[model samples]
Structure formats: C-alpha cells, structure tokens
Target chain A: MTSILSGLESVKQALASQQFALSITQRNVANASNESYTREDAVFADVTASGGAAVSIQAYRDRFLDFSIGQEMQSLGKQQAQSSALSQIDSIFNENSGQGLQEAFSGFFNSFSSLSATPEDLTLRQQVLSKATALTSELHRLCAGMQRVQYSVNSSVPSTVDEINSITSKIAALNKQIPGETGSGNEFALRDERQKLLENLSSLIDTSYYETESGSITVTTGQGGLLVAGKDSYSLESSPLSGSGFQGVQLGGADITSTLRSGKLSGLIGARDQITGYLTSLDDLAATIAARVNQQHAAGSDLDGISGTDLFSYTTVSTGSNSGAARSISIAISDPRKVAAAGPSGGPGNNENANLLFAVKDEKLFTTSTETASQFYAHLIYRVGSDEQSAAEEITTQKSILAQLKNQRDGVSGVDMNEEAVNLIKYQKAYQAGARFATVLDTLSSDILNLIGA
Target chain B: MRVAQSETYRSFLGNLETLNERMNKLNSQVSSGKKLAQLKDSPASSAQLIGMRDQAAEIDQYQTNIDSGSYFLGMADSIFNEVNNLVTSIYAKGSQSASESVTADDRATIGTEIRSLRDQILALANSQVLGRYIFAGSRTSSAPFIVSGDTVSYQGDETANKISVDRGLEVQEGVPGSAAFNSIFSAVDSLLSNVSSNNMDGIQTALGQFASALSGLGIARGEIGANLGLLNNAKTNLGSQETSLKAQQSQVEDANMAEAVTGLSQVQTALQTAMTAGGSILQQRNLFDILG
Candidate 1:
C-alpha cells in the first residue's frame, strides 16, 4: 500500500521539519548576544509511526538556577545597601582629615588648661569660650549629619516600595500570559521576562516565588506575605510612625518592617537604627558634658569673685531625658569673665577649678561610667566603621557567589553560536537530501503513471 | 563549562572592571600616601589613632603647663638671687653700725643707704610679671606690699600659687610675699631704726635676722630651682612621647608608597593583558564567521 504520492508526502514533511530546525538555529545565532534570551531547539518527531515528520521548539532553561540567583540577589542587595549607608556615616565621622569631634574635645579641654595657667587673663578666658563654642558646634554638625542620613534612608522606603509594586505588577501580567503560550515557543519569552522581574523584586525586598501547576508563578515576601499570586499583585504601603516620623513599611494593614531580615528594605531599616543609636550616644555625651562640667563649674568662682553658674546648658524633654542634647547644647555664659577658673576658697589667681575641668577629659563619666567622653565617641566611630567594613566584605562575598551562580545559569541556558552554526549545516544538508528525494519521487511517480497508461 | 558567546565577553569585561578598580585603589593609595583614608578602611586602627591623637593633645597641654611653670619659677629664682644680694649688703651695713668705733654721722649715712636697699627689696617683693604681681599669692591682681612711713604691711596672703606641671604633681610657681620677704622687711626695719637711733645691741639682733632672711631666700630659690628641674625633665619626656606617638600614628595611617607603586604597576600589566586577550578572545571565529 506504499504509494509514490504518500512517499512524496513524507519527503515534503521531512523538508518542512528541516527548514523549521534551521530557522531555530538561525534564531539562536541571532539572539546570542541577548542577556535574557534562552536558547531554543527544534525537536523533530514522526507524525505517523514511520512516515511524516513534525517539529516543536524546546527552550533550554533551569528553574533551580533561577531560584538560586534570586536568593543571592537578595543578599547582595542587602549588603550593598548597608555598605552605602555605612560609608556615608563613616565620612561624617572621619577623623583622619582633622577637625573632628576628637580634635574639638581636645581643643576644649586644652583651652581650660591654658586658662588655668593665666586665670586672670581675659584673652585666655576668651579662648576657653571660643573652644567651648567650637565643641558645641561640632556636636551640632555631627548630630545633624547623622539625622540627615537617617531621614534620607527613611524617605527612600516609599520609593523602594513603589519599585517593588511596579515589579510585582509586571510579574502578575507575565504570570497571566505565561500559561496561555505554554505549548507555543512564545511562552519562553514570557517566562524569561517573569524570571527577570522576580529577580528584580527579590533585590528590592526578600521574596520567595514558585511556579504553579498552571505555569503561573506565585510570589511572596520572606515572611510569607503574598505579593503576586497567579495574576494578582499586592502593594506595600509606607506610612510614618507617630513619634519618630520615620517611615514604616506595611503590607495589607500589617507592619512588616521588623520582619524584613534581608534585602534593601531591611538594610535601610537597619541603617536607620544604627544612625539613631549613634545619635543616642552623642546625646549621652552632650548631656554628660553639660551635667558634669556644670557641677564642677558651679563649685568654683569666676574672675569676678562670684560663684560660677552652669558653663554649658541644653534643652531637656524631662528631668532625666538625654534626647536631643547634642542639638540643643550651648555655652550658657557669653562673658569671658564668667568662665570659672578659680576655686571657691581662693582669689583670681586660683586655678583649681580650671584644673578640675581639664581633668574631666580623663574621667570615666560617659557610658555607665566605663569610658571618657572621647573614648565613647571613638567607640561610636569604630562601631560605624567596623559595621561598614563588614557590610562591604559581605557584599564582596555575595557578589562573587552571585557571579558564579549567573555563570552556571549561563551554562544551562545561554546560546552557543558555534553550536547553532553546526546545527544550521546539519539542517541545511537534511533539507537538500529531502528535496532531492522529493524530485526522484516525482520522476518515479511520472514513470509509474506512464507504464500504467501503456 | 560551556561558555556562551555573550558570557565570554561579559566575564572578560567583569575581569577588566575588577582590575581597573584595583588599579584605581592603588593609585589613590600612592597619591594620597594614606592607607586609611576612611575609618571604614580600618576601624580598630582608626580608633587607636584617635586615642593616640588625644594623648598627644594631652601631652601638648602638659608641656604648655610645664613651660608656664618654668617661666614663673625662673622669674622667682632670679628675684630671690637679687634679694639674697640685698640681704647680704643690709647685713654688712648692720654689722658696721654695730661696731663701737663707728661715728654717728657715719652710722646715719649707712642707715640711709640700708633704708634705700630695703625700699629696693620691697620693690622687688612687689615685682609684677606680665601684669600680675608674682609674690601676691592668689591675690596676684595687685601689689602685695603697702609701705606707710617707716613700716611695711604685707597685703598678700600666706598661700603660694601652685601650678600643675605634671599629672598629680603641682609646683609652687612663686614664693609668697609673706614667706619670702616678710621677715626681710622686719629685719631691714630693725637695722634702719637701730642705726638711726645709735642702738648697738639692736644692730646686733638685726644682723642675726638678716642672716636668717638670707637663708630663707636660699630655701625659696632652692624650691624654684627644683621646680625648674622638674619642668625640664617633663619637657624632655613629653617630647619623646610625642615623637613616639607620631610614629605609631604613622604606622597606623600612612601607606607604604613603594608597595603601592609596585602593586599599581602589577595591576596595570594585568589590565593590559586582559584588554589584549579580550580583543582576540571576543573575536573568536564561531562556525557562522568561518562559514561566511
């Protein structure tokens, strides 16, 4: 029952299949440079048990590699964010360039020592005032710098949330389109775009996602809060807290700021807390300076032979509150004569009180009486610097890991132009053989019809 | 690993970027000469540097104190030396007046000279240095002595002004007017009165007092000399401390220029190699190019 016409039909199907395979090879070569494009192969199969041929496009990709990349992207995002914020703090507290808090503190205390040398000298008294003024101004500048950094970090939350929402929206749209084009070669493009969007979302906030049985992906935050489910995307809200005026991230009316463990959002939140901690330490320094110096100064006599008042003053929220002390601290007395340089029992030449003030530099007064003001401030700087350094190290580690994962993914899914070229030659040769067979079948069928007519 | 065409170029570019970053870092280190441009570069060392700077500042302040103390003590030592000379002259005048062969006119002339010398001693006792009376104890704003007619009243206190020259070590900057010159003033008053009234017994007593006053001046000068010695020792010690502290700070902060420069050139060579390889590596003939 094998006829020339059916034989010709089988050759025709073979030729079409070869052409399809060649086109796929051409497509692979064309998209070799595209970062997101996964390589495709035309899979040929017999339509019948032994006769006709058919082809379908198969995309080369690994779901496990994509998942690993997403996780690494999250870690890299967190480290990069922390490193950047800490660098800003480090610059603000940089002492190597001089004119830092350490210098200001030394200047202030050293001025008191000089004042003690010439207790009655008006010029020396002025120097003490000037140094004190400079110290207060330095404290103010540092506090403001930290506050600005905190504010900037806090304000960025809304924009980051917006970015996450935008990415999730794109993912949901891709999720809708992926299942519709599942059997067709177009599904590869939809899946590639969705995977890219998922990686972008993971960097903004720690997230986990999985492809459903229907080929649609479901995305959730690290804490299992739904983001993109099937074809629907959820949005994150940013609202300010009551007392601090800092932005808090919320998902569907639930605060998720504290639950965020890794990603840019968490890193920014952690940075804000670190900055606040530094600010608190600075306030403690300012408050302790005001209280301790005022006590010693009040026990002494000024150049006018009157009991000294508080040398430094700051606004207080309550009786024992140290908050905002750095911002509010100021020299209480303006007159140079008001600087307490003499002891209570002695005349203008007495510098006992001035000596005591200078001695405050070494006192274990701040941080639960374990460190001097200078030591505490140095510790704060060390903490910031070390935190930044650790974050940078983490980023380096994460980046290398991410790079390796990306290369592994490339090995699985990336296009090879050389392989494509070889496929092109094989498919072209097959197509030519099928064409020659079709021409031979046509001649044989003509000869068979001529013999039957005779 | 099955490298894709894009992956090869991408990895090459990444390697080039890393090499370039290293070169830039080394360049900055060489140009700036500081290994720790930021605290984050080395936090522990940066903290140590801050502490060292603070200690240096403290040492500088202590040195200033030592200098001020030395100046005051040096002035006091010279004042006492002159006082000792005046006391010696007064004692000779008293001894001559006490001699029985001396004429009343001769005694009167000697008494006038002794009186002039006592007035000079009083002036020395009230000497002001840098607009503050040195011998006025804590009341240094005004003169310590008030002379009314033949007698001198001490207006200053008995307290000696102590200046801090070292930690827990305070040195008396100047001898109090009462301690250094009060007995001298009384001795000179006795000598003047005894010579003018021709009292030989009183003249002998005044000579004895003058000897004691000279010894008192010697004690005060001895204390001043001891303080000056302490100040000098502190200055030397602080100088060495400062030098050592600066050395430690440099160790923590300054970059090794030789190492940085060598590293820079090494990175440059790597970058050039990478670039050259990239040119050939990326242009690798695939089947498509060979076929064409």
Candidate 2:
C-alpha cells in the first residue's frame, strides 16, 4: 500500500538519524578522558508509528552524583589547604638535621663546660663568646622563619577571595545561556557546557546547583551564597581590615562566614589564622629563652670583674592583646680576661677580684633564685626540647586523620583509566553497528525505488 | 540489579569507575609509609613533627652540658689538691727557718723561700680552668687572686664557684682565693717577718698563724670533696631520669612498629580482597557488554 518513493524518503531519514548517532558516539569517545564531560546517549523514537525512526542525543549525567561530589570535594579542599599550611610550618621548624635551636643550645652548654676546665684560658673564653653568639643567632633565625610563613598565609587569603568572585560571575553567565538554548528540548550541548562550568567552579570554590523546570541551573556557594539565580549573578567581595589580614569575606555587604566554610577562601583564611598563631608561639619561645638566659648570665660574675651587663641582645617587638610593651635582652661578657689581671693590682693577691670570681662560682651573687646559671640553662634546654617534641607528635597524628579523610573523598570522585578504556571500546562498537544499519536501510530504499520505476 | 543499559545505568557505571580510581590512589598512599604523602595532606601534623624533631635534636645538647660540667669539676678538684700540697710546702719551710742553728742569712733564705711559696700559692689561686678562673666563681673573665710585695689578696669574692649538677641542687666546686689562699698568704707574711728578725717570740706566734692557715685549707678541701660527691650523686640521678623520660616520651609519641606493621598488613589484605571481589562481580555481570 505504501509508495516506493515514500520508502526512499524513509530510508534517507534513517540515514540522517544514523549519522547523528555516529556523531554522538564520536563525541563520547573524544570526551571519555575529560573529567567534566558526561557520556551522552542517542534518544531514538519511531517516526509517527511508521517503519522509520529519528534520533536525539541525551547526556548520561546524574544530577545527584554531581551534587554529592561537589560536597565531598569541598571538604577535601579545606583539609588540603589546612594540611599545606601545617606542612610549611613543619619545614620552617625542621629539627632532624641538628640545624635548629637545640644545636645552638648544646653549643652554648659545651662552651661553659670547656670554660670550667681551663677557666683562666683565653682561648676557652673566646669559645664561650662565639657559642653564645651562635645560639642567639639560631633563635633569631627560627623566629624570622615562623613570621615569614605567617606573612605568606596572610597575603594568600585575599587573592583566593578574588578567584571565588570570578568563578561566581562565570557560573551566573552560564546560568543565563543554558535556559534559553535548551528551551526547544535540544539542550545536550548546553547541559554539557553547564556541567563543565560546575566542575570548574567546584575546584575554585565549593558549589551546588539547582535545576528548574525551564532547565536553568541556580548555582550557590557551599556556604549558601546565591551564585546564580535565574538570569542574575551575585558576586563575593572581601573588605579586610588593615592588619587584620583577610579575616572574613562579604557578599553584598552581608557577612557569609558559615557559607565560606568548605571553599578555597575558607581554607586560605584558616591557614592564615593558624600560621599566625604558630608564629606567635615561636616568638614567645625565642623571647623566653633569650630573657631567661640573659638574666642568669647577667647576674653571674664575668672575667672582667663586672656584673649586670647582658650577654645576649634580642630584638624587641610588642605582642599580645595589651598593645605596646618594650622587651629587650642582652648577653655579653663584661670582661674577657682573668679577674686578677683585670684589676688594678694585676695579680692573684687582689682579694676584690677573687671575691667576684668566688661569688659567681659559688652562685651566691644570683639574687633572683637560689638555683645556679648552669641549672637554669639545663632546664631551659629541656623545656624547649620537650615543647618542640610534643608539637611534632601532634602534627603526626593530625596528618593521619587528614590522610583518611582524603582517601574517603577520593573513593567517590577519582578517574579510572581502565574504565575509560572499556567505555571507549564499547562506544566504538556501537557506532559501527549503527553505521551498518544505515547502509542496509539505504540498500532497501534503492530496491524499492527501482520497483517504483518499473 | 538488572543489567544497566539505560543512561542512569551508564551514569552509575561512571561513578563506580571514579570510585575505583580513588581506591587505587588510597592503595598507593598506604604503600608509601607516610600518611601525609604531600605537603597538603596534614599541615598541622607536619609542622608539629618538625618541632618534635627539633626537640630530639636538643637532647644531645643536654648531654653535652652534663659532660662539660664534669670536665670543669675535674679541673677544679685537681687545682685544689695542688693548693693543698703548696700549703704543706710553706709549713715545712717555716718550721725549718725557726730552728735555733739557723743564721740571719739562713732566715733570709727561708723568707725568700716563703715568698716563693706565696707566689706558688698565687699561681694556684689564679689557676684558669677551661678559659675561666675556676676560683673566680661565676666571674670567669679574670684571675681571682693578685699578689704584690709578698702580700697576697683576693681579687674575687668569697663566694665559692658552683655549677648546677641537677634540678634544685647546685654544687660549689671551686674555693675562692679570698676564702682559701688569701688568709694563708697573710699568715705566711707574719711568719716571714718573724724569721727575718730572729724573734723566737714572734716565731711562736707566726707558727700558730701558719697552723690556722693549714686548718683553713683543710676545711676548703673538705667542702670541695663533699660537693664532688654531691655532683656524682646528681649525675647518677639525672642519667636515670633521662632514661625514664625517654621511655615515657616514646610511649606517648612513638609508633609501635610491630602493631603498625600488623595493622598495615591487615588493611592491605582487606583492600586486595575487595578489589578482587569487585573485579569478579563486574566481570561475571558483563555490564560493559550489556551497556554496549
């Protein structure tokens, strides 16, 4: 009952449909390696209940999967950021190679030991001075390194905020384009593009997307800031107080502290604060060591027959919530020779010089505590060592926790090369079969056309 | 549970693929022996480890301090013993000069010998241990005693030289020139004057002063000996304390290698089984063929 001419038209339509399917398969093969690319499938429908068919492409992406991945990524991102900051601090305080404050402390102690043996030896006196100098230098270096790490964190926070704003603007723009382009039900390309945007946005900041009936996506920050609502885009801007160092971010003059918790901005902010706290502790250690050592050294008698002059000079800077307070330390030898030669009498008969030496040696001149200089120094070394050891141990524990979290996150969203290879082979075979079916349809149409001519 | 041929099934497969990739990464992490494989893994822990490592490095310094203290103490003891011998020599010279058979010239010679002995005492008092005047106490920059015209005086204070042997215990190891040698010099000065004048009455008085000087030296020697004993005791206690602290610290912080290794092996086995089982299930279902 059907005309041969109509059969040819059906066959031509079938060929066109098969070509579209082939193109879609090729697109999948190309994007199998792309992290953001969702594999697309052909949507086929029988043509008006006749023996013909038409095909449309459908992207095989789950909205729920994307949403869940984004949430997990956000958590992983924050952990990574915090971990980075802590590791940097660790490198700054590298203690294993004997290149830290501990070594300097040991050197100082050794100098005192040598002095005890040849107390009147000029060479030993010089060694003590040298060792003292080295110890103070080590303290200064450590304090400076900690401060530098804090400064780096402070500077990085604002830059990350700027990146978040740029990503938000991009998402809002995509939100506008997707709804208009997909209105006629040909939204495969638009959806693909939007998915790519979401993936990109996730890396810069934690994001979630909402799909409306019109196929438009509404994007929001992990912290719940409206990134894209219909056709409009909301931007985030940070107004950091000078010297407060990028403490918080603002979106449209409203504070969004909770919203920024899982993004790169949050990570940077946390890192800055944590590093600053660590630097403060290091400064405290340096100040305490310098002050205590100088106090003991100053109280004790020196070879030059003078007392009270400091042995080490430490740089003073105001710290804590109380504002400006002057603190300084100086540890310097008052005299570098024998007390007898240092005095006017210039011999061992000088009782005044002898008395000074006796007082220091006996620790009777120490007005503060009954403890001697050597005892105090020993305690200081032990205290500092213990503090550093405890911190390192804590760091190790935190690292294990971080590792577990990362593994959990990776379990949900990592790419597998073997899976991609299998997908490529499968899609390739399907494309070939679709192409052969189109050829057979063409041959049938040709036979029908010849019959019509006869 | 049916073979997933629909787009939803394909999407699920994609998720499973991603999950497999993550598992591989986790496997590598486990094998690497470090929980934090990168700087970003755990920053706080890394920083803390650095601090602890620095502390471990400093333990050697405390040991060095103990060794140095021991060396100083040894030198101080030797100098004190020599001063004791010098005191004996001066007493012998004074006694010989006090004999009735001795002439003025002989007395003069004895006086010269006494002055020489005084110089020797000064040398001992001004003895430098390491680079410091051991007798000068904390005033290590100069000699504690100065001698001029046969009169020896202490340049340093009467305070004995003390070093910290342990917590709350400081041991004075060096006798000050003012306390030990200066008084002896004064006693010898009086004895020399009596010998030169041939005054038997003065000689008798000077002999009493010399004996008193010897007694003072004996007391100083006794105090130093006592302090040496205290130092030895403190050193022993510190050694034990350090050993106990090290054990406690290890318990608190160090990983138990045997336990860790066992745990690691268990996790590895579990991971391997999961991978093999998951692989077999996927293959038996032939999900890829069904989807194609």
Candidate 3:
C-alpha cells in the first residue's frame, strides 16, 4: 500500500511538472506578437528528494534584451523627431518652386534691362513701373509668409509647455501605482502603462528614466526637473500668459527658460528665431535697395529737364507717428517737348541725361566692393544661391543619415513577421507536447489509484 | 585598417545622396535663373540682389532719359546752325546794301531779307519737341523766347535737367532752352533791327552780336558732342560688366553638363550595386525552406 501511494505521489509530481511546462509554453505562444514580451521558460527544480521527489517550475526572463530594446527605442524616437522637423522646414521654403522671391527679383531686373534699351518709350517706362510694383509686392508676400510662420510658432510655445506639464503629471501618477502593484511581481500591466507614458513624454521632450529600489521609475525632463519621485508626483503648474488662456508651464513659479533642445517644440523655436531672423534681414536689404535707387533716380534727369521727384518710392508702412500711405510712385518726364525735339540743347549740358543713363551701364555698379546698394545686391544673389544649395545638401545629408540610423535600429528592433510566424509554430508545438505530457501523467496517477483500491 | 560593410554602405549612400541633392538644387537654381529662392536662402544676398536689380533698373531708366535728352539737344543744335546760316546769308545781302553805290530800293530789299531771317530765327526758337517747347527748359509748355519789334526775351528757367549716370556720378542732360538758344535769338533780333533801320554804327554792333550768338551755339554743340562721347563710354563699360557678371554667375551657380552627366552615371552605378546586394540578402532569407 505504501509503494502504491509512493507511485501515486511520483505520478502526481510528474503531472504537476508537466502542467507547469504546458502553462509556460502557452504563455510564450500567446505573447509571440507582443514586442515587449520576452520569451519565458520554465526552470524546473526537483523538490528535496523527499516524499517521492516532487517538482516546481520558475519563470525565467533575460533582462539584457529588455534594456537594449529600450535604448534603441529612445534613439529611434529622436531620429524620427529630427527628420520630421527638417522635412517641415524644407517644404516651407519650397526652393524648387520657381515662384519665389528670387524669380521676382530677376523679373524686376529684366524689366530694367528692357527699359534701358528703349529709354524714351512711354510703354517701356510703364512696364518698368509695373515691374517695380510686382517686385515690391513679392517682397511683402515673403515677409508676410515669414511673419505667419513666426506667429504660429509663438502661439504653439505655451501649448507645448502645457502638454509637457500634463504628461509629467500622468507619468507621476503611474509611478506611484507601479511600485505598489509591482511588490507581488505582477507589474506587467503597470509596466505597459508606464511605457505608453514614456513614449508620449519622449515626443514632447527628450527624457531620462531613473529606476527606484522598489522597481518603480522616476521620470525626469530634459531640463533636469523631477517629474516623478517614488510614489508621489511633483505637480507642475501652468502659468497663464497674462489674460490669455495660453498656459506657460512653470516648474517653481519661474519660467522654463531653457530652449527646447529637440523635438517639435525645438523645431518651432528654430523657425521663429533663426529662419525669421534671416527673412527680416532680407527685408532690410530690400528697403535699402529701394531707398538708394530712389535717391539716384531723383537726382537723375528724366525726359523733361526737371529732377527731385523720386523714381522708385519704397512701399514700406512706417511705424512712426507721421506716416504717409501713398503706394504709387511717379517717374514722369520733366520736359516732354525736349524728348520730342531730338535736340541736344533741349536737355541739360546738351543731352547729359542720356549720357548719365549710358554711364550707369558700367560694371562698376555691380562689381564695386563698396557697401552700396548695387554691390549689396550682387553679393546677395551669390549668397542666396549658395545658401540654398548648401541647405538642400544638408537636408539630404541629414535625411540619409536618418535613414541609415533607422536601418541600423530596425535591424535590431524591427519585427520580422516571417521570424514571428516560425516562432508561433515552435511555441505552439511545445505547448501541445507539454499538455500531452500532463495528460499522460494524469493517466498514470489514475491507474495507480485504481490498483491500490483493488 | 578595415571598414564595416554596413558603415561603408551608409557613408557612401549618404555622400551620394548629398551630391545628388546639391545637383538638384543647382539645377533648380539654374532653371529658375534667380539667386534667391527664399529669404532664408541668403538674407543679405536676397536683399542685395534686389537692390542691385533695382539699381540696374534705375540706371536703365536714366539711360532712357539720356537718350531723349540727347535727341532734343541734337535738334536744338541743328536748328541753331540753320539760324546761323540764315543770318550769314542776310549779312551778305546787307553788305551789298551797305555799298555807297547802291540805291535806296536795294537797301529796302536787304531789310526785307533781314526781316525774313529774323522770322526764321524766331520760328527756330519756338520749335517744339514731343509737343512741348524744346528750348523752354522746365517751362516746357511755352516757347523758350519771345520776339517783339527788335528784341527777344528769355521765357524758360535757368536750371538744367540732371540725371544719375552711375554711383556717385550725375550728369546734366538738359540745358535750359533759354540759355542755349534764347540768347542767340536776342542777338539775331538786334542784328535784324539794325540792318532794317540802315544805321551803319548799329549794323556794326549787331554783326558782333550775331558772331557772339553763333559762337554760343557752337559751344552748346561742343557740349552735346562731349556728352554723347561719355554716354558711349558708359554703355561700353556696362556691356562688359554685364558680360562678366553673367560668366561669374554661371561659374558659381550653373552646372557643367558634362560633369553632371558623369556624376549621375556614377550615382546610378552605385545605386544599382546597392539594390543588387539588398536583393540578394532578401532572397537568401527563406522561412519556408527552413520550415520544410
């Protein structure tokens, strides 16, 4: 009877061991599609050789793979953020489109060339006037575009700060819950929730994680502000910008003054400060050109033997108290009869105006190293072309770099469907074998019990 | 000593992509034929280019003014010369009348000839260019001079029209018609009056005035000639400058077709090789064969 009971106890131990193996296999099969799920194995150990040697199973996991994957995800997130920002900037400039400020400048110049060829033609003069108008209009358009971009970026600053605050709060709440729930070693759900928060936090700003002694994470922002500590979250208050509902996040009632280093927020600030600054300089250049040209045109003789009227009036809206709102500029001939007569004495110094016009055709106007408007324009053209080429080159280089990084990262972390499918088959077969082993052990135990009863 | 295949591929691909992007950008710049695509491309450059373009435009406008001014001055010079010739013919006829052997009728006939020359001079002074009085300076709506009885009065401003020729350079293109021709007309008027009245002393005085007027016209003509010469020089210089600018621009921004074609071919070769290698790697990984 004691032998039969011993046999029964051995059969029961075998059955329990097979059941534990089957459950582990089933868990692996179920989690095959989960990215974060590590392949778990049952660690079987013989119970101290007493009472016919019972068996126990322990779940095994590799922590190294988990840490590696987390690192790769962080890098991938940064690359994605940078690539998106660059692409946005590139599209906004749209340099490939011919309808840009450069084309407008060229058009204005071409009109001048045409006017030069036929100085006496009223039609040509009118064409020049129209071209000047068009050029100025284009300048205004570009300025307005840049201004719009700036305003949009400024508007987004407060909102992004608010988002950061809210995300920090959420992460803190999860941090408190994760530690308590993880004491029983069943923090899978808590970990998933924390990872989701982390992903959201990364999109807003780059972050770092500090693991506590109790298996909970303390989240910190790029600026080194404590986001989550132990089980308690430090609250971040949204400081409203004056009467506006625009929430500016303050860490300790002090403004977060550090410029966002990366992410969409950084992109916005870059566009507002750097890109818009360049555009404003361009406007200054346009203003200088108009002012200088107008001065020269005013000094020069027209078809008439009169002067002092500006030829090209700048259309800038003055921000001063006494500003005139006139938009049109007149370049009238002072002496129409003189133009008609084709006589030398009809003009000053026997057609000196004609000589003046011809003299301006000299290369000195363009090649002079002086900071004059003419030379400025020449340099401007050269710099703009070169800058555009370089910027585009940089964009391509960055994009290629990003692609290569993505490929490298993907090689390590990207899910291979074919590999997963194979894993699914292997896990499924292991699960079936474990279940069959449990069934065989159960049958053996039942047969032993029947023999003892007889 | 050694480079990883992946690292080499990434670097080469990155460089190739960068070169391709640069080429595309250059092609766009060339095709657009503009130096600035946006304000950010080169703020200084864009600003400067706009200004230069405007300057070029303004210079062209000044040139137009100069051309018209030149034509009017030329007409004035020709008219003055014609009046001078007419005065010389009248003086010759007056010389014949002044001979002691001549009859009273001959003197009257010479006076009539002198009157006609004076009228011709008056007409020349009132000559219009482009429907405005050419000799009237700023007051172009009216004739530059008025003739009544035996005197001509100036009727135009003293100021000449000035225009910009180049940077830091401006030239007067329109001499007041009063200065160029009205004074000459007044002298001619006095000479005609003296010749008609048959006063030998007055005639002698009038001959000197006529000579002075002729000299003034010659001076004005010389000034016009000098201005025309200046204009020609300016045009020549401008043309050369424009040529050099174009060449420089081409050098900086324009692509060499031959070089671009060669580069494109090289990139294509590299791309083909990469694709072939990628394809082979993909083909070697077969889960079905492993499973079987």
Find the candidate with the highest TM-score and give its number: 1
- TM-scores of the models, in the order given: 0.97, 0.67, 0.68
Q: Model 2 — TM-score against the truth?
A: 0.67
Cα interface RMSD of each candidate: 1.6, 10.4, 8.6
**Candidates in descending lDDT order:** 1, 2, 3
Candidate achieving higher TM-score, 1 or 3: 1
Summarize candidate 1's per-residue lDDT along A345-404 as a digit string, tens digits: 677777889888888888999767899888988898888889999998898788878778
Clashing pairs in 1: none
Better of 2 and 3 by TM-score: 3
RMSD of model 2 against the true structure: 8.5
lDDT tens digits, residues B79-189, model 2?
768877877887888888878898888889888887887788778778876455767654546676776665666666654444444434555655565666767888887
lDDT of 1 by residue, B134-234 (tens): 88877888899988866888987765656665666666665677877878888888778888999888888877887787777777777888878878887
